[model samples]
Target chain A: MDILKEISENLELGDFEKVSLLTKKAIEEKIPVEKILKFGLIGGMDIVGEKYKTHQIFLPDVLMSARAMHAGMDVLKPFFIREGMPNSGKVILGTIQGDLHDIGKNLVGIMLKGAGFEVIDLGTDVSPEKFIETAKKEAAYIIGMSALLTTTMPMMRKVVELLKKEGLEDKVKTIIGGAPVSKDFAQSIGADAYGYDSTDAVESVRKLFNQA
Target chain B: MRPVLRFLEDELIERIVSEARDVLCKLGVEIHNKDVLSMLGEHGAKVNMDKYHVLFTNEIIDKALKTVPKSFKLYDVLGNQTHDFSGYDVYYTPGSAALNILDYDTNKIRRPETSDYIKFTKVVSGLKNIASQSTALIPADIHEKISDSYRLYLSLLFCEKPVVTGAFTIEAFEIMKELQIAVRGTEKELAQKPLTIFSCCPTSPVKWSDVTSQNLLDCSRFSIPVEFIAMPLSGFMAPVTLVGTLIQHTAETLSGVVISQLTNPGAPVLYGGSPAIFDLRFETTPMGAVETEMIDCAYNEIGKYLGMPTQAYISLSDSKQVDAQAGLESSMGATLAALSGINNIAGPGMLDFESCQSTEKLVLDNEICGMTLRMLKGIVPREDFPTLPRLEELLKEKHLLISEHTRKYLKEEFYFPSSVIDRANRTRWEKEGRVTLIKRAHAEVEKLTRDYAPSRLPEDIKKELTKLMMGEARRYDMKRLPEIEI
Candidate 1:
């Protein structure tokens, strides 16, 4: 069997150790880093995501598979850097300022990373300047903001405004989420997208890349 | 026999009540309101002002229980008594204070404004099985300072039924009384023909905060029935064991009852609760969980044993959307609450762990309530003698499909669900586009609104209410409320 297929199957089984070993063996056997990432780790996570969407697997099962995929990604990440190749793309995420809630944002981050995106999680209470600075530093394409409070939903709009002021409006896509944030609010604030939940966040990022 | 659901034996209920009294006497309840503390102290409660504790003796609780009437009547807008909380009469009201509403037209969830509250009130007013209306959606357009009183004003303006609502602050509580008095004409008449029952809650772990305790006292003084809602999050703010939580719940409720009765000897009170097990994984109170239904049933048993009219937060779904989980959890909780003989079940139309309100869910839950109440009625054999002869005579025919007995009792015996619950075969259902419950609910809402005429109110009273509400708005530095076309 192909090594990428083996790695994908092991990741599906949530056999992190096996995924790591197979990924390393594939590395040592001279498979390209980008090829291993796209055909193996991302391929495995795509199946897990679909399984989640279809209700075939729940949070715990998907989380276990995500960890296994991450294990494989860890083995392949340094090789990609050494070979001067991007994994998928960079994305910056955080719960917006005045909001201390991050569980939903963290879930989105995990899903993004599982989808093979290199996520720079800015954590909670992130200001618009912080998001912009991190997005600039990471050269991230998408900036995802989450706010659990209605009072802090405007911070998402401020971040978008800041991006526009910095002339980065066309360069970076912005997505907002949390309990109170909605698609209408996203449109009202001129955000590039709105993610109703964590899985929708990953899909929004994918759609952004596709549109680009 | 009537369908009955009980979780605890009479002995166990007594034991739980006994332990609850011990909890109150030993640990004591924390009452933050100074007036209530002083009042409790005057009533021979062991009050520690510095510690904010009021320890109730068996004498205090027994006296209070003796004075608390087993049932009371709630009146509607026209000063007609509508709700009789006498015995096993269970009524369903929608969940209260939801910040967001699912807009039927947009099919989007949004923070509701006053217009949306009006829409919700109209929909609820039309739902026949829903016994009372609640301020199901909080308007986001109003200022926080006036929101509570403003919501009460809207309830008075729109709902003709007895309202189930409450106030956030002492000022808001006073304003609510003013609105009630304006509707009922005078303070004495307000007390006599109470058009609303105020729900006052005690914080979990046996604590009654200053505001809520004061609201309890205010309601008692006004002669409005107060629903003492004790929400104990099991395993977190409350004890992990169901019995342990019940002990806390009973203690909290008993303390409220004692204070309320002391304030006014014959004040009406409802023993209501909204308890849920703290889910370790989700870190949420699953209002629709089986554990919640069990707790509601058990707590209600204690209420009945104490001869108090009871209420429970049931018919609520934890599901974010109206789907299978929503149907399963909501129907299960509603059925359990109904069978348990809870006097008032207040959670229809609530979703997302009771955070979001949906009129569609309310319509759907009206159907659920109808089914559950039908189940609660059980089967009533009309004739004293066995119908074996009639059955034999019917069986002699080719079929009993058109028997005289069947024709006589068919509609009376079974609850035929309205158009929302599809009972048609697959062929006919698909031919009719296989509409889902939510879509059907949307259609129901549309039909109701299109056919809607404002409930009759005297023109003078209407103008007075408008003037009073506008006066409130002007106090918040506004000329009038935001307008929406009726």
Candidate 2:
């Protein structure tokens, strides 16, 4: 079977070992990195997402396949990046000030990059000024803010205040989120958008882009 | 009539509060972590020159406790809000699952981005059973520095019900404000009342870190009803006995309430504790242990008795995952919580002894919550006492009421889950295809995600968001790359 086909199939099956083996073979054959990334890896993930969309796959299966994809990517990581530049997208991500929990935010970051968004992760405990400054410096269009603490949930709103006060809110479309954050809060805070799950965020962005 | 537990006495409330203050004030809760000592000193608590502990008298606590609000309001999607959380009208606070997607490209695990939330919201917005929505796990923005921001935005679009969520940094808070405006169309309307968020201070009986203090200040200033979750690992970070543990929990929780209210008086606060004991055997805190349940029950009683709305971390277990242990522990935990009449139940789908979160477990726990609520409904009368002639005629020499027209409503009158639990007989089940509980749950989860189409977002807003994201990519010197063909 074609190596790409094998790799994609293994990823579909959530077989990490097979993915690794196929990855090695594909690498030995000197398969193009871009092709494997798109046709093999990304393709497999898309299928997994769709499968998840339906009843064809579940969390454990997705986790297992993603793990397998990780193994295969490890072997080819050095080569892919060394051979060429790492894939990148423009993103500005950070946890709101006074808040430090990031499991949800971090997960969003991973999915963003996987979906081909260039990510700029500002570590947690970030402030409003810091976000504005970074967004300005990077000229980032989408500024992502996350808060996991109820105490800090308001800080996500403060970032919006800073942006508005600085006249940066319009220039940068700010998106806010966390366990306690809601669309109502997002709108009241004057943010561009809010998301519930990581994947839904990705699709929302894509939809936004298409509409734009 | 409900069985009243003696733990709910008002005298006990007064005693416990006083005792907790005395212990902290006199003994000055030990400076277990040096860093915490510095933070407390910085935060206005007077530290003895020696810095072994910080002395705060009963007066200070009394004064601080005065700032805590009894309740706050959360506006609904229709603009209606509720100050009380004990409506007993089940509200949705985001699904209890930690969903992750691996970036095969990056070979790293990450939370999904905006698109993830958009889909979820479409479903959530449509869910009548859900009282509120969550910022789930997606962030709304795309940050080349970290990850995506879908979870953040979807909280705006999904359920439209009040959201249960938090922020990681101040800037994120700003975006959250903007998103609220986007959803509701006016920041002024959004700010008319307090927005509640559950911010976690570092596990207490341990120490309050600097950031944790900052988080408190942040929420207090914004008037976000804050639920300070005080998690103390017993026998490790806390005391070995239940009484000692309660004292420790009281100190920690009271301290947070004081700080938050002081920062902003009348700011709503809810007292909560997820206090559990370490098994010593597994070297892990068994969330399923009866002791854990007892501690929660005791703490909840004390808090509510104090005239504060309470939050309890219940419906959780010590199991590693969703299995028999998970079922047993969750059933007991949820039962204790519902019967105890806890205002809020956290860690519903938490598994692996709270080490991890699971989607499967969340869906299953939702079912459990339903069942538990039903159980709390107490027994109902079958009306078979007299064996009336009419009913006997309907039964007519048969032990079954199969021919009774009223029987048709029996299924509707009773609630049944389609997955994760089985009710079919051996032969029917086998014939229908012997599906395992987990497998059935998996199927259910898939169906939910697939069919879930929450509320919709305005077209203009979506377009604006996308334009910004792509522009951000270009600004970061990123390539548009190629299209992902389905």
Candidate 3:
């Protein structure tokens, strides 16, 4: 079997150790760093994402494959930095203030990482000011907010307003997603995009950067 | 011969209990309240102050279990015993704390106001099969700060049944306790015959929030009966496996038991939970899912093993409307919960993952509850031992419909549902306007609301309740409460 094909298959199977070992062996065998990342790591995640979007696999399966892809990425990261290859983009993610639900937020973070975007997760109950400060400090390209409670959803509007007040709305796009959030709510709150679920969150982020 | 259902065998029950104790000792539970942490530290448990985690020894768990009353009685506002949560008897109540209500008129899910809650209370009071009334809907008209106490106040006024309620904030408990005390005339009298059971839920994955922790402690301090709502969403907040979820449920519930017992020994509590299976497709917790129902029954077995009265949020549906799915899911849940012999069975009239409640569905579920309760009586020889005599009477009369034995056991042997259940022949059904279940339920709701007489509370107590509620309502900048015809 081709070594890259073996790596992609292992990553798809969520065999992190095997994927990492194969990526290391491929690196030792003089495979280009970009080829290892694209054909080996991203190649496996693309299939996982497609399967997830098609409902052929569930969230847990997608999350496992993401972990395996990260294992492969760990081996290719130093090489990518040495070669100055850019990542997908940096996105700041968190559950809005007064809400302790982070599962949806964490799933979005995992999918963003699986899609090759850099995710700075601030965890749950994150205030609006913290989101703005993090985006400014990280120079992030997007701010994604999640909320599971209708009560805490209004806090998402605060984050959007803060982005405008800080004059970062043009620079850092804001996207919101959760069970209680809707496209109408996002538009009402002046948000740039609304993600219906984790899969749509990635697509929305891609669209925000005109990469879709 | 009463029919019963057991989801776990003796050995599995032991294993689950032992594992839950092990989890408490090893993993411990994170409590957000510092006072609780210090209290646990004082009680000889290993308390991690920095993390607010308390690791309990088996000795502490055993001590708490011994103090928990195996059974307790719930009383109505008139001081009449409404429920005896002992033996294998099961009682049904509507599920609580829904954000929205399915409007019977509009056929839409909308936020409930004070009037909606009053109508709910009035309807619940007339429900013969459902034994207790819950503070089911959160009224959106009131200030969120007073919403918790407002529901309790309304329930007390409009209904005489024992209330199943909980507080959202620590301050709300004071007013709620005051309301109960006013009804019972004193703190000691209220505790003696508890008029309410506060639901103190522990956050899944073995954690307790500050507000919920305080509510648990307050209920314990007053010796008010509490049901520890250990809501472990399977495969999401908790483990993927059923047994894994049970262990988390046990651990979380035991942690609550320890807190309540340590605070005030002999605190009345019911081992209860609202566990649901996570639907991966929609990312929703479907309470009506079979796995969720199994989790509810399985935990009831565990609760029984611990010698505590059990409560479960079963007999509910995830359907958006009162349709076939609602009927199927709710009847399945009610039947299973009844067979399991859960002491306090909640989730009647609940829909959309317990986020919405429907009065039409409540009327429908009352029939379901009546049927399930009759099933619990089981088949027994009721004067049928002398089969020859009844056979002769049937043969002589060519029908036994008016016979002595048939007439005697008519009400006992059969569950006669209300008009909500369509049991008539096709001709009669069509003659009765060809009404749907939702339509019949709408008629029933209106009839029940119209027929409900005023509650029998004394005039002085009624005035006291109004005074107390108005005082709290004014604190939230409200001058007047909603108008109720009753």
Candidate 4:
């Protein structure tokens, strides 16, 4: 009875168990892994993102969808690696050093993952060097830093300076965000962009790659 | 005799208060300030340091309630008593901290500047029914760092009424407290008269941020009157039911009371809230919603039962313009809040969910407030012990227009609205250019601003206020303060 449709519907409902079961069932039926990942998993998340953007759904609903998507993706990851299905992009995200606030950063991570971007979340209190070293190691397309305190806002500037010194500014784009961060602060620090909120973070990343 | 509105019976109020106390004792409230958390711990509360939660026992709650004054008095800049925030005596002030002003000329909402703030102060100063002036508009021309204190400075310079103000940052409180002191000369005199009432809001669903908690502690230390604005959006941040929201409001407010009383016993606080029904369709908190007003009245009853002065952000509209929607919503809110005996009714000149302020609407709401105050003075016999005498006099005169009884009680019995109410007949209305309510309100705003005299504060006090504000502005890299015509 249309196993991929069942998977997508279950993902949207945030039923992680049913989504995982349907993904395993689709794989057993010998449907191509790419079709399940695209039409089954990412298809459901796109709806969640749009509903969130329009305020038809709220944060809890979006977070539940992200969880359901992860459960299905866990089962599909091995198949994709074997078949070499490429993700849209990779991003490195973290809260700058001396700032412990991470709720906003975590929400952006969830939304980025829902949008089909592979997000490497370096947890809160991450140093500037850790952000760049990991970006260079993982070859991330964008590096996102967050700072909730005015004191820790300077760390974002340090990350930008290190990126310039290493001449990786052309290859890797930088985006700064937090309660105290603004577009003017971003320009003054020589960063590529500033994200006003979590939803805006996804759009900013897409703009950096000319994907929007 | 005063008309009163009661939404909850004694049994229901007792049940609700019991439930709130149980929630506070069992679930506890999360306070982000370290000093407050430890202080609560020292005061016999069960403190969960790891989670920053404090559980209050019945004894602690009772002790705090006993010390809270049932009422307080507010003094104007000249040390004249302006407001008695005691039982059933309602006072109207403009809503505070609006980021936008509904520009009279453009008929559009835009970021307010210092000039707009000055004009708002001038208009509020001229308003008769609005008892106190609020630091209502946040001027965009100033630095965000000093916006909180700057609003107060403008209100003190251009207006004389006791201000209803608040601070956004913990550091800003020092300057705000100093500004109040500059008016009254010293901390002791300032505390004695208490020229300002600070609004300290707790985060909804039983939590207080570090900044707001610190502000409460500081206000308590100086004996400054504070109103705990606990905003719980029903169906969203709070339970979907009205009673459930009331419980949350009670618990949040009680936690603030305990904090203040712990800092200094007998600290004055008003049981205030700004709860709204979160409209699922629009994803907005409509303050003017009927259920929102019901929550306000119900909680005011609870506050009165608890023996504390009450405040609410009612008598305001969520409408984007000063249209029929604004008038109806605001009138309904004012009537309900006044009958419910909310002592400080802080919602005039407010629109767009309290984000925008219009001086034109302030003029209209002033009349609404006057009507409500008149309604509060329910049908009472003035000089007519026998109704037959009044009827005979009315029958003899054929009209009571020039009779002694009419002359004595005409102003008392009837609320005379300004020209904004459109009392004239259609023919006369047409003769006067057939002006709409908006046009009439705009003209009144212009007349008030033009007729406003500069504040009568002593020249040295004015100079001192300017110097202190200039020092604060310079700290944020602003070289000069904005010029005011006065």
| Model 1 ranges off by over 4 Å | A1-212, B105-108, B383-404, B484-486
lDDT of 4 by residue, B1-486 (tens): 788899999899999999999989999999999899988888899998888888999988999999989999999999999999898899999998998999878899999999999999999999999999999999998999999999999999999999999999999999999999999999999888999999999998999999999999999999999999999999999999999999999999999999999889988888999999999999999999999999999999999999999999999999999999999999999999999999999999899999999999999999999999989989998888877887988676443443557656867888877777886544346645999999999998998999998889998999999999999999999999887866
For each candidate in turn, the TM-score is: 0.68, 0.57, 0.69, 0.69
Candidate 4: regions farther than 4 A off: A1-212, B387-391
Q: Give per-residue CA lDDT, model 3, range B12-45, as digits (tens).
A: 9899999999999998999999888888888889
lDDT of 3 at A34: 90
Score chain B of each candidate by TM-score.
Answer: 0.96, 0.78, 0.99, 0.98
Sort by TM-score, best first: 3, 4, 1, 2
Give Cα distance to truth, residue A41, candidate 4, Å. Answer: 93
Among incorrect, acceptable, medium and high, the docking class of model 4 is incorrect
Model 3 chain B lDDT-worst window of ten: B423-432
Q: What does candidate 1's lDDT look like per residue over B69-180, in tens digits?
A: 8999888888888899978889999999998887767767899998888888888888888989997888999888788888878777777889999988887887788778
What TM-score, to 2 decimals, does candidate 1 have? 0.68
Docking class of 1: incorrect
Clashing pairs in 3: none
Expressed as tens digits, the lDDT of each residue in A83-199 for candidate 4 is 887776899999999999987897788778877789999989999899999999999979999988999999899999999999998989999888888888999999998887777
Worst 10 residues of 3 chain A by lDDT: A52-61
For candidate 4, list the clashing residue pairs, or say none: none
Model 3 ranges with Cα > 4 A deviation? A1-212
